[model samples]
Target chain A: MQQNEENDNPPLFKSWKGMYWLVLGALIFQIILYYAITRYFE
Target chain B: MSYIDWFVLLGTVVFITVYGIWKTRGTQNIEGYLKGNNSEKWWTICLSIMATQASAITFLSTPGQAYEDGMRFLQFYFGLPIAMVIICVTFIPIYYKLKVYTAYEFLESRFDLKTRSLAAFLFLVQRGLAAGITIYAPAIILSTILGWNINLTNICVGALVIAYTVSGGTKAVSATQKQQMAVMMGGMIIAGIVVVHMLPAQVSFGDAVQVAGEMGKLNLVNFDFSWTDRYNVWSGVTAGLFLFMSYFGTDQSQVARYLSGKSISEIRTGLLFNGLLKIPMQFIILFIGVMVFVFYQFVQPPLYFNKVETDKLANTEQAAQFRELEVKHQQNFQAKSEQVQVMVNALQAGNDTNVETARQSLNSIQEEGKSIRKEVKDLLKKANPNTEARDTDYVFISFVMQYMPVGLIGLLMAVIICAAMSSTSSELNALASTSLIDIYRRSVKKEASEKHYLNMSRLLTFAWGVLAIFFATLASRMENLIQAVNILGSIFYGTILGIFVVAFYFKYVKSNAVFWAAVLAELIVIATYVQTDIGFLWLNPIGCLLVIFFGFMFQVLFGRKLEPVEIGIEKPLKSGK
Candidate 1:
């Protein structure tokens, strides 16, 4: 059976946790931006 | 279309197809064919996953959806990033450790063969139907707008996909997707920029956006909560999360893409990349549609965007009445155009009061225009009962054909076809892989040689392509192509996701409990979909929670000590432990 040895290091982020947080942050930023667009344009 | 346009369209599509087949030649083994030799890097996996999900309908109907419904559609993807993180943490490592070809293979190891087969069968049913829609959607729209035969268009798209998919399998699907995604996004961005440029010279990009906002087309985020309201913050975050979890975690079409990654880390990277980028890409596409809405405010759009149906009514006895409606539509457009100018001037002058007044007048005229358009649609349906009365899907394509420069038109058409082929190729590849690995090889041909299985994989790929084309012929009855695809997936995805959720968690709930639990849960989900007005996204969480709930109930009641079957592999890691 083939086994995948886990690699903890990502290319850019300090850790996978960091990457996940970054993605979450991006989502929050986008939602905020869209909400701002809605309000500003309104 | 001009000769130059034909050349560009044919040149781009043929180049990509030939490149995919040529690059992936000499794939003779089942692993190489089905799993792309497990050699794919994160970038290939990223593009392949995104390409498979985008599909032709995403390119064709989404902009039009935004054009008609506003950017609220974007909220539908808000949960994707969260789902990506969850799958990366849980699903990726498990699948890689297990070395499974299909997601259902994990179910069999964790639960039982009946459970695996049930999940695989549901996938085949839903994905098979969706594969046809993937081909039919762009075919119907391109055929109508470009005056091509719909059947021939369907066959052409299906055959192009089958050619490469059957020849080189998953590798070919991934190889071609890079180019397909490039062309699809590049063409869209170009279209977006061009649409803005095509706006009246006096209307700056900001002005166009402000006009769209004033017309209520920029409603990107709605914080309000309603169970039946499809795209809102609550539904998008909670229900959308479950839907994405099921789709990326359990669906073989997506699972197969990442399963080809060279390492678990690479797969995780690929999925996370998609999660981070998918929403913004959708925003650009939807923003383009809003810009088109603004563009049409200055120009007189057709009374009906679907020329095929509208043209059919042109020679009928209803033609006179239709002409009257057309005349009224033009008058409405003229009046709305003037009001838009008033709003734009007020906006430019920085007078909030005048801007508000002009905005109100413009919105009222827009309402009158909508009523006239509705009457035209009603008349068209009365004139021909078979007409697809919904024209939102045609809005963007109509704009492209009537206004875009000739060669770019060809590029845009290629973009649509490329999207169709990229997604269909992935579907056929996944469908064949799941069918061969989970069903055929496991049940009927357990002792087949590698060469024999490889041959069967190719044969099955071709067979699924044919079946998809057959289904495409009957797809006309469905409403808006994008919504139809999502609706069909929702009907089954929740139950399938539930089975996987159980297989991962709830260790004490044995196969007997979950197998029957899944059966009951799927039936209930389907019943809910057919009988209720609950939003489709809600089905994912509903179906999954129901499975977990019932599995526990069954285990508590039955208390059966059935011995677990050893499938000649390492036992899966108990999820939490």
Candidate 2:
């Protein structure tokens, strides 16, 4: 019952899980960018 | 340091302290003192969490780390976002639903009293020592560079943190962190700009970055998986994940930061904010170091960045040899400067072959300079074995003193001091909370009134502050301040993390089995640290896995009746009793 109430209705994302996924995606994006920076500079 | 620098440093630090005390003036009860009356919004929690994690060492030593070792250290945080997600999903709701003050209070409901006590004991020990490092790290460095007495600096830093922390407790810590985080990041950004601007007029910021990249300072990620390598992608994502989970999930200093949130959603948002911003913030600071590295390419840097030790060497019989090495160092610097210029020109001309050639030449020059520096270190060590010959901690401060404008120098110094105060205040506040909640109030004086407990909290905060100051006075040089703290945390974090993981998941594993398993796992983890070549990050996962593995084995071996406890997500208060 408490869990149901605490399910955050994020303003941008539809669900809390979606926000987590977005954060994970952002991390991946950063990693890919860093990789590109490394390869381009190397 | 000039008068402007002094005024900026003192003014910024004094204002923050007074503001923290004034803003959190009233706390008549234990709950208000320990948990800030649950009045914090997401932003305060976010900044408080960030400030707690980033110590003065982060400011003083990280740029120096980038200067010496490059930005690969950024990989250390790769697992943090995932850890934040895990904590938000698993840890936060449980803590909030339980309405627990310290994270250990949840352990008691899930397991038993001994289990909770053991976890709390581990936290107090590790964090107590860490509090010392947080205070000592910047105090020693600031004093050495600015010609202040180290003892006095430690007291001053410790005293300021104690003032607001003892007065306002968690509210004070959270209130001041908002401003400290502002000054810290703002100062760092300003320093970054000034570093790039200090570069020769011909070198654009892009050219400076290209130079740093060519010299291999921009190696941010390595996909190569090695068990022994500390900052590779695999260890970072795997071991780093476990470490961050333990730090955010179990460490009271961190737990207390978010536990003050007005709601579970606020805590989640605050943590996710940290997860997203922390990496970019680290990247910026490291890039500042990279820029500092590039700045030194055109302008000659000392053979040894630690001038005190080098100056002492000048007075020794090794003075002649040091002078000879200095000449060689000067010549190497000239060659490296020319090669760097060639690399810059090649980069500007868009000639890949010349760029590669010049980059290789510059790398060789750097290698030669390193050899000379190593010899200088050897000579310094021979002159006095007690000397801290490692100068990486001094690099950034040396740059600030030598090159930065006067007012900015003070502001940067204020940045370091504020970082120290912010982190130390949180640690002291957490220490006092855990001591009072987990130990003193729970065990020693269980029937104390609300007013009595509040007074005890204030007393414990002051006691911990003094203990930290005492440890700071006795502390010596570490190889790198940031890594030293992390290594210390990793040593104990894994074991604590394991206990929490078992409590949250393994319902059949009773308190006795987990209690003993944690003890054995902690011993084995310590043994592994003392005996093996395993990277410190791996210790987190290792200790965690050891406990889970041992927990199941011990439970079956002991033939304890498997009374499955209800580990459901019902309102924790209703579920626990």
Candidate 3:
């Protein structure tokens, strides 16, 4: 049976862990931008 | 609809359909037909998944949602990126190891055939109906807005989808969607820019955004928590997380997308890209709606966006009352337009006091306009009880027809139809593969050749296409079935996801416990839905967690020695091995 985990390496990140953090961090950054937009416009 | 618009719309749609069929022609092998020969790149998988999720209502209703409500709805997607990462980590490796066709195939390997069949049956029931809705929802909207026959529109869209999907299956669905996603995002971005340009010359883009903010349409982040409130941050993260997890992980339409990826890493990249892009896509659509609201503030908008009902009201006995309300609406627009200018001017000068005072006055007048609009809807309903009074769905399409240029109008129409076809094709392709691999070969015809299975796959795809069109035709007569279908999806998705969660996570829970637990959990969810006012979205988590909790209990009581389940595949998928 095939298991591709050993073959996987994401670009710009040494580990998939770093890649996932980037996604999560982007979410945080997005929420902060949205909150700022809401506050500034209000 | 000018000649150029018609040409562009027809030209773009026909081109995509033909391209899909041409690209995937002569797909005689089962692997090639069902999984695109495992040749898809990350970009194709990304676009296919995104296109499958974004139906026509997403394009039509999202902007309108922003127009009526605020961008508070963006919170609902806060959970999507997180769900993507989780799926990439937990779900992808298992499916790749199993070399499964449908997500349901993984269930059989981990548990029992009954468990796998149960999940597949639930998917067919919900997604089968949803496929029709994918076509019907937009067809009805476009038909009403463009004065075309709803049935004809349904058949055209359905037939166009069936032509390519039946011919080429998964490869066709993925190939066509690249173009579909391009048209969808391109049309929306262009529409957003155009709406900003359409605003009064004196009002800058920043000024218009502030007016929307003042008018309460830019409520992007609502940190407040409430159980009953739909779009708050609290509910979006929790309930919304379960919903997306079930959708992206278990649902075959989405699973089929990444399942076609050439490598597991490519699939992971595709999903991660989708996670990153999905929220921004929704924001653009909603921002366009807000900008349309700002544009309408300067220029007079219809008292009601749906003119069919309003026109019908004009010939009724309530015509005089309708005319009076029309005049009142005119007066309301005149006052509101002038007040908007005042607010814009105050905002520009940075005079906070004048801005606040103008905002208050503007909101009061906006309230008056809202009441007037409600009165007109009530009048329309009174005139004809069968009239569809809510016009929010019509809001964006009406703007497109009225404001967008000739060639661009055709492109926008292409965008709507492309969204419908993209999702519908995925549904058909997934349904066909599920029906073939999960049900027929496994049970009905265990020893069939690949040629026979390939033929069956194409035949099943065509059958599902016809069924979807039949349901789309049937959908026109049913009132509020869209909401019913959504509730239907939420109702079953939790239990289905629960079964898979057990298959993956609950190492101790055997088939007997997990299977029966799923049944009981579904029963409780249905009973609660019928007996209580609890929102439908909550059913997903309740159903999921209940399965886990009950599986543990049942495992302690009735659990017995496991039947050694078969991992049926004899070879590796080699999926980037």
Candidate 4:
């Protein structure tokens, strides 16, 4: 029953590093988008 | 409230509670009770983590914060994803490998019994007080807005949560949160749509955002760095990372959420899920508040959002002065409301010049409105020194009670109530687990039957519930309920995080060094909090760094006399058995 990458093999990514980057990348994207909104609105 | 409203509120809450109880009915033995028998899926863990973090104060005070302070508060969560990444990378595997029941359990293995106990005690002190606030914040607000008894409201909320949390423990808390999160998101979405719909017929959703921006309500990010400023991009990323790392990394309320996951991937996936969605969640909530700001551009909001204080003020001799200010606020609103339309029409026509001219007019009136509000607050204090005059926290709830349609009111109430219950259950569960795993079993009772320990866990959970109720009773005035929680967390979280940081990375710094380091670091954090104007977020990093620094310093002085320690070492769980 314990089939899901016990050694930290992520479902989609080759490694957990990919998942971490994806999240950090999303954070960066959000900040850039939010900054754009701030610039555009203000 | 109407009959239908009351029915909807009670029915929704009751069904969720019953479903949680029925679903997690047979939680027998200490392992199932504390760790949900390690059977939780990733999605359930995700929502449970968010639910535990949200609390009643989040639902009650966040929108109000946005209404008064704009979306700059979104920056407060900027460090969350980063923290999630760190926890996954460094904290999760060690925890799973160790098979620990609480975060502090890892501390004992890495350092010693004293260090672990010290961390547990800090968590208990902070999470205990937080449990009380989670119950009290919404109940107090609900009672104030609806003319109900505050103490009765607190007891009822506490009792409702205890009813389910005591029966099933961690499993019940997690199982019920899925339903609670659904209600929370669904109701908030409806409220957002309704706010936009309630805007003037001529004003489009796009137009409202434009208006909010022109009025300085869309302040989503501030790049400026200041030690004193609470929320901005710099603080959010740096100081916010430390705060969140401490929270999700060290605090058992959150740690317990992920620790229940069946596998390392489940915990990591669920936590990353939180990172992915949390900002958007906060953004949506804050955006709704901004839309309410836009809605009020067309509709006249109360001069003071707290109706009770205003009504009480009217009965006093200063009624004439208050009445004069109300008239001034109304006239000011009247001018701004019309000017808003002119600006909106100017935007439609693509006339930047006309928009700028009208924006100037709106800004001037808004400034006048601020001074008028300040005068009213000053006069309120002059009328009765005992009255709390911070009305911003009441803005969103008052708007909801005054304007949101009947059934929606009930659903929204369920959202706040569910938030309160969901978080309080987590705190109570975590408090009980920490008490049982760290204190009662480790120190007081050396050996016991599994059945006895199971019963003790249930009893400790119940005891914590009663203590939370007691703490709620003694709770007094604070600035904003949501920020109040964060401020309290910041004071203690840094030192806790620092101790964990030292244990994880600096093996040379053994138990005695880090324990005293944490102690010194905590004292300095409290002193800094008491003695400085530094923003609360900075305290997280300051306290954390102070611990690492002191840990190294103390280790240098004390390392020659102690046994060696190593990382990634597992400790057996002996107490819960």
Q: State every prediction's TM-score relative to the real structure.
A: 0.96, 0.96, 0.96, 0.97
Off by more than 4 A, model 4: A1-7, B476-486, B561-564, B568-577
Candidate 1 clashing pairs, residues 3+ apart or interchain: none
Cα RMSD to native, each candidate? 3.0, 2.5, 2.8, 1.9
Question: Candidate 3 chain B: minimum summed lDDT over ten consecutive residues — where?
Answer: B568-577
Q: Docking category for candidate 2?
A: acceptable
Error of 1 at B525 (Å): 1.5
| A-chain TM-score, model 2 | 0.74
The CAPRI-style docking tier of model 3 reads medium
Q: Model 1: per-residue lDDT, tens digit, B1-577?
A: 9999999999999999899999999998988998987888889999999999988778878989998899999999999999999999888877887788889888877877888889999899889988998899888888888889888999988999999999999999999999999999999999999999999999999899888998999999999999999999889999999999999999999999998888778888999999999999999999999998998898888888998898889788889999999889999999999989998999899988998998888888988999999999899989978666898889989999999998999999999999999989989999999999889988877876889999999999999999999988877655555467668788788888988877666667788899888889888988998899888878889889999999889988995764444332435532111
DockQ of candidate 4 (2 decimals):
0.53
| Residues forming the 10-long window of minimal summed lDDT in candidate 4 chain B | B568-577
Tens digit of lDDT per residue, candidate 2, span B40-91?
Answer: 8788998999999998888888998999999999888999999999999988
- Kindly report which residue stretches of model 2 are placed more than 4 angstroms away from their true locations once superposed: A1-7, B476-486, B568-577
Residue-by-residue lDDT tens digits, candidate 3, B1-577? 9999999999999999999999999987888899988888889998999999999999999988999998988999999999999999989988887777889877776777888789998999899999999999999888888889998999899999999999998999999999999999999899888889888789999898889999999889988887678897777878899999999999999999999888888899999988898899899989999999988998788889988878887788999998999899999999988888888889889999998888898889989999998899899889878777899899999999998887889999999999999999999999998898888887788886788989999899999999999999999998788989999999998998888777777777877898999999999999989998887888999999999999888988776753333333422332211
Candidate 2 — number of clashing residue pairs? 0
Candidate 1 off by > 4 Å: A1-8, B476-486, B561-577
